[model samples]
Target: MSVTALYTDLSGYYDLMCADIDYREQSNYVRRLHELFGNQGKNVLDLACGTGPHLRHFIDFGYTASGVDINQPMLDIAQLRCPEAQFTQQDMSDLNMDAQMDLISCFLYSIHYNQSIATLTDCIASVHRALKPGGLFCFNAVDKSTIDNRAGIKRQLTHDQSNFSFQSNWYYSGEGEQQQLQLSIERTTNGITEHWRDQHAMVALTFAHLQQLLEPYFEVHILAHDYERIAPWENAAGNAFFVAIKH
Candidate 1:
């Protein structure tokens, strides 16, 4: 399926469906990670910065913020949300920036969009090259174990004139190394209903595998859960957060 089409359909309702997310708190946590692991510079880049809520927070906190995403519709919304920052249309796997950043963040498990280990490696390499020496990279991912354990889930929401519903299911293929998230969405606005369905693929990587992949270009600093610092193995919930520094 075309990911661009899926996101284009979702762009208008993205923030509505994600109303539960506390972007301020999440951004504060990202800032804290930068303070703990970064070089204390103000230049920051947000990868896959959909709708720019987190980027707006970084800007509010006085960072020289910039954002990049593959979807132009999403970038359009982001540009409106944070006019002070630059927004670019680019894929994470082949990101190019004229200036290196002091910190780079890919939040909300956006790294999983790479869909394959080879592409994920390319994405990480791009990020490494985009970061200045001692710069920090922070991201979160769903562990393979977590993907293996997922069950079918459903959600519904109503915001203003739009009503939204989504059903999600998970599948594993290729001897459990690849995971897929199947999403079915229905949106009704002003009494007009639209349906969209898409399956997104991700390369399931264990904490050790991800660490090994990054060790070549970055100093793996922390692997925790839910933004709290903890041992990687202790994260029974399958949500993993990572902070690394470019060597």
Candidate 2:
């Protein structure tokens, strides 16, 4: 899909498409990260914080939380959903927060949205700049399993609300970088059919690559399996979450 169509399509069903995410579980993950720091600090900056679902947890935990996202509509919904917290419309790489943060989170494979390696490197460097000395930075990336195990040539999921249904047919390029998806969505009440053909490019980096990129700036632990701590190679199966403390 063209960039314009990509933005329009996502804006139309952003909430409906992401309704299945377990926000409580995700928030717990963030809270656990903070708990690891003990008495170190109390402020957080959530980058690419879509819908601000995770920010609520930090606020409830008594930490001052602020969120930033590139999409305006998403930021609007986040602002409304989290009126108590600060939400700004901005690109992650371009952020310039006057205050340093104790924690920074970019979750849910949002880092891969950067289309190029240079941009990805810049994002990491920017995170390093935004964090305080010894502050924690955490983010997740798509495991190659997501590419290898990808199937479901054609699928239809009917959300009880007929107007909010999800349907897609997908197949990936052998390299796993390119994905071809044909999406057909319908709003039963309005009888509006929104059709889109999307080609998304992704880069799946390994633990080794990420380690090399972050070591200079951080003391890192790779959480290959569970959320709380990094396990040995035995459990380093599919997904991995990297937690790095700025040095």
Cα lDDT computed for each candidate against the true fold: 0.83, 0.68
Pairs that collide in candidate 2 are none
Angstrom error of the Cα, residue 189, model 1: value is: 5.4
lDDT of 2 by residue, 32-121 (tens): 866775237888888988778788777877888889887787777777877887888877866778788899988876776664556667
Mark the regions of model 2 whose C-alpha exceeds 4 Å error after superposition: 1-12, 37-39, 144-146, 152-161, 167-186, 190-192, 225-236
Q: How close is candidate 2 to the true structure, as a TM-score?
A: 0.81
Local error of candidate 1 at residue 201 (angstroms): 2.2
User: How displaced is residue 163 in candidate 1, in Å?
Assistant: 2.6
